[model samples]
Every structure is written in C-alpha cells, then in structure tokens.
Target: MSHTFDDQTHGADITRLFPEQATDTRSHPSRPKRGDLAASTADALAAAGAATLICTGHCKSEIQHVIDHISRKYKKVNMVFVTADTSSLASFHEAGRTIKKMGLQIDGFIGFPSVMAVPWEMTGDGHESHFQRNYLCYFLLVNILLDDMVHGSRVVLVTSCVRTEAPAPTWVDVRFSNGEDYHCLEGYSQSMLAMILFAKSLSKMCGDRSIAAFSANPGNTKTNVQTYISMDQMESWLERKRIEGEEIPVSLQQTPKSLAQGSATILRGLLDPDLQEESGAFLNHCQALKLPHLDFPAGEESAQALWRRSQEFLGAFL
Candidate 1:
C-alpha cells in the first residue's frame, strides 16, 4: 500500500516515530543488534559460532553490503550467498541440497523473498503465482531445511498488514478460479495470511526442538515488493483501504516506515531475546499484536486447514 502520512503528527522526520537501532551501508539497517551493537545475520551467527543459511531475492546488493560489513567487523563469521528464485520449485530443491552439502547447521533462517500485487498467473510448479511464490515455495524450503534448524533457532516469515486490510482468503478457493475472481490485493493478502498461519504451524510442529517461528509485519517501506504495483492499482487499493480503515492515507501501511524501520521489526523476531517465549506470535512494528484473524475460533480452524493442505501439496518436497 498507501504511504501517505499526516504531516502534522510525524513532522518532517518519519524515522523519528519509527526509530532504527543501527545504520548499515543501505538506507535500511542490516539487522537490529541484540545489545548495543548493530545486528545482522553475520553478527548473530558469529555470536553463536554457528552456521546459517540465508535465502534472499531482489536484495542481493544489500546482502553483499552486509557480507562486506561482516568481513570488516565480524571477521570470524563466514557468509555464503546462493541464488535461488522462490518463484521456482526446482530452484529451492537445488538450494536445499547445496546447503546440505555444505553441512551447514542452520542457526537462523530469515525468508525475505515475496512479491505483491502481481497479475495472476500459474507458476511452472502448477500453482497460483502468488501462492507458489509467496507462500508455498517457502513452505517447502523450510520443511526441506527443517533437519538443519537446531534447537532454539529462529525463523522469520515476513508478512504485511495488508493481510488484515484485504478480503480474507476463501479457504475453499485460495488459489482462485483460474484468476477469474482474483484481485491482486486479495491474492497478495491471502499469501500473507497463509504465512502468518504457517508460522504458527511451524512453531507447533517443532515442539521440543524449540525452533521458534514468527511472522513479522515490517510495516510499510518503499521496496521492490511494490515493483509490480502500477499507479492505477495503487490508487484503487488506497481508496479501498481508506474506506475500510476510514482514515486519511489509510492505516494499513502504518505511516510508511523507513527501510531501516521496516528491517527492525524483522530483526526483532530473529534476535530479540524478549520474544523467546512468544513463538508463533505475529510481530507488528516489533511488538506482538493480536490480529483479528488469529483471535477468533474460525481463524484457528482456517490456519489448521491451511497447514494440512500445504503439507499435502508440498508433501513431495518435504
């Protein structure tokens, strides 16, 4: 969504309201540190003296910058970048084998690959583009790497407030009727909601192993996630959200976070010690906020149904 904000409330500096913990080479901070220092995948792995497998897309430049920062600061941390497009199922399978061959014990996995508001199409894997790319592929990858995730490890599935803004998924037809009834916003929202539910399922499935999984809403930042959103589509989505939230500029996006601010909520889910006991919690702006979908009985039923369906669909990969 909408990035519009009230000039009166936030003033000139939007970062003032959504303060970031540390700075990185990119406009956004790489990660929020556990202590006073800045946090990154490198920093976390270094602290634990463990190996981690990071899966990313579209932000490779930013990741390379983090790799550079790690070399200079945390010399002990070893970083490896693998190119795996989440849109393709075969790509994830190869990536999983690559990690396994490295014998890397995955200490933390932060999945940041997602697309929004794209026109409907089926992926080569014979699934809806949004479902396959945004949710299913990641679902398969996580299950594929489940063997490597050690005790007390963390998994962050980046989600969005759009999950709440758009029309909830019709469980009977989440993939949509061959794009006939598909609305870009609805499709994106459905995937995001599946992510939230999947995080909960992941936490429960890990059980005694203590692999914490959380779905984080990074607020709103101007990122490549909006690349597919055209000006006309943006206006229509904003108008719809405005009517729903009944607030100027719409509240779904929440005052437009900086790249750093958006990254902070994600880092919190990954490294924040305070959230250790809050596994499967949905982090909104770095806090555990109860969403309407999760708070109701029907929502829980939908989540269970989704998890079961996803497991069946991705059974071969798992």
Candidate 2:
C-alpha cells in the first residue's frame, strides 16, 4: 500500500520541516488555490488518464490537498500519496522496493523538494549537509528506479538559479564542513549547483539508455519553498546589503509567479514534443534559460566531480 503522513501530527516541528509555513498550517497565505503549475501538471496527467504518485514527504496535508483539489477537477487520476520522507538514501530504497511490490510503472518522475536557507543542517545518515538532502535523496531514488523505467522515461528535478547567487564550492569541503564560515546561501548555492551538474552528468549516463534527465527552474513563484526566509531575517539581510551597498537578491525582491505559471515550465519540458529530442536541458519559465549571465555546467570535470560525490554518498545503491 502507498504511504500517507499528515502534517497536522508534527504540530510544532512542522515549522522547522516547512520553515515557510504560515500561522495557519491548514492554509497558507501565499499558497494559491488554483493556477499553480504543480496542480496543473497533476491535472494534465489525470486528463491523459495517467496515474500520479504524490510524495507528500514532510508536508502531507498541503500536497494531499493539492492532489485532491486538482484530482477533483481532472479525471481522478490514480495517485498514490507517498508519506515517507525522501531525506535519506535508505528511504529511497525502501520506497523503490515498495513500488516494485505493488507492480507500479513510472513514466515521469518529478521532484519539487527543498528546504530552508539557514545554516547547514547535517543528515543523520551520512552527516552530509541538509542542502544536499533534497537533491541526493531524489538522485538515489532515480538510480534505484532506472531499471524499472521503460525507454522514454523522463526525470525532471525542480532546481533553482539562486545557486548562481553564491560562489563555487571548494572540492574538499563541498559538504560544508565549515558551513558557519559561509553565508546562508553559499552552501545552498553549492548544493543547487551540484544539481545542475548532476542533471548534465545524468544525461551523459543515459546515453543509449533512452532515458532523459532535465533540471527545471520554475522561476520565482510565491511558493513555500522560500518560506524558510522569515520576515525578520529578510529585514536583517536587507539592512546588511544596504550597509554593504549590495542590491537585494531579485528572488527576494520580486513577486513570485502563480503556481500555474511555474508548473507550466516543467510541463513544457516533460510533455512538449518540441523538447522530445532535448536532454540535459535547463529550463526557466518553460524555455531554455539562455541568459548569458547565468552559467550552465562548464565542462565534464565539475559534472564528474558532482557525480562522483553523489555516487560516493549513495555507494552500491547506485
């Protein structure tokens, strides 16, 4: 059977797990009822008579509400809410095993998991920074499910361009052993940067495998993904930036896209026949982010480094 975990049970810890959670856990101030990309994608899947696997993770109620709220408008897709947390590689393995037992077939896999911009938090399993948890755990699950996917499988990871806001990672301490030494986003930047390389490297590994890997930048959406940034924290950072004569981060300054617009970008990459031949493409707002200022993976070297570290963390699981 599929897993289901409710957010209500967490009570206090819900704030930590979902730092952006509003005063009312039942409904968020920023959460849009309709027109968000995520629900729209689910609706599209349901319309195509496809089944959906919603991994609610730590925010069960919110994700479940999205699935239910949208499934009602669509064809009522066969969705399974995965209550298990994808915070660790071991959990990824268990979820894979469970899916295998249920005889489920996955055609498209999308991950929108993320966390706060606070100081680096270590994982209990590998003692890796929490920043990597969002990407690494999903990477493990994809590896585990690779053999299960038929040809033409699509793996889309919702990453951020905010990574460019920070500098490159030091090879030795990429896990941020000296996290306190870096700015809040510095470590997060490293993690997000690793995701880009991971996407590029995954495409290389998929050569002749008929599988495609893509990284999606939903652009600025008023989602809880940034809820980790509290108002007080924002003020403090803004004051610091002013004193330092630095401009506020655009991501923090602007209004976010509607949920519909954000998810549309991912849908374009996943279902757009124009992208059928595309692999390892990084998308922003449903188009190839061609901004000259933004950097994609430079060479095979850094991609390899990320792939190596990922495999090292995952070990035989890959």
Among these predictions, the greatest TM-score belongs to 1
lDDT of 1 by residue, 50-164 (tens): 3332434434563565656555665654556665676678787777777778766665666653567888888887788878787887787788888977777778887777444
Work out how many backbone clashes candidate 1 has: 1
lDDT digits (tens) for residues 1-318 of candidate 2? 122222112212222232221111111011113454455545544444454444435445756676676567654445565544646667666766666565555566776645546665677665445455657877776777677665666677777654234333435666555555555555555666666666667777875876777777766666534646766656665576668676666465435665555665665555444465667777765565542222444446656666777778778676
Question: lDDT value for candidate 1?
Answer: 0.62
State the local distance difference test value for candidate 2: 0.56
Error of 2 at 273 (Å): 2.1
The parts of candidate 1 lying over 4 Å away from their true place are 1-74, 162-170, 224-231, 234-249, 295-298
- Residue 273 error for model 1, in Å? 2.2
Q: Quick one: RMSD of model 2? A: 10.6
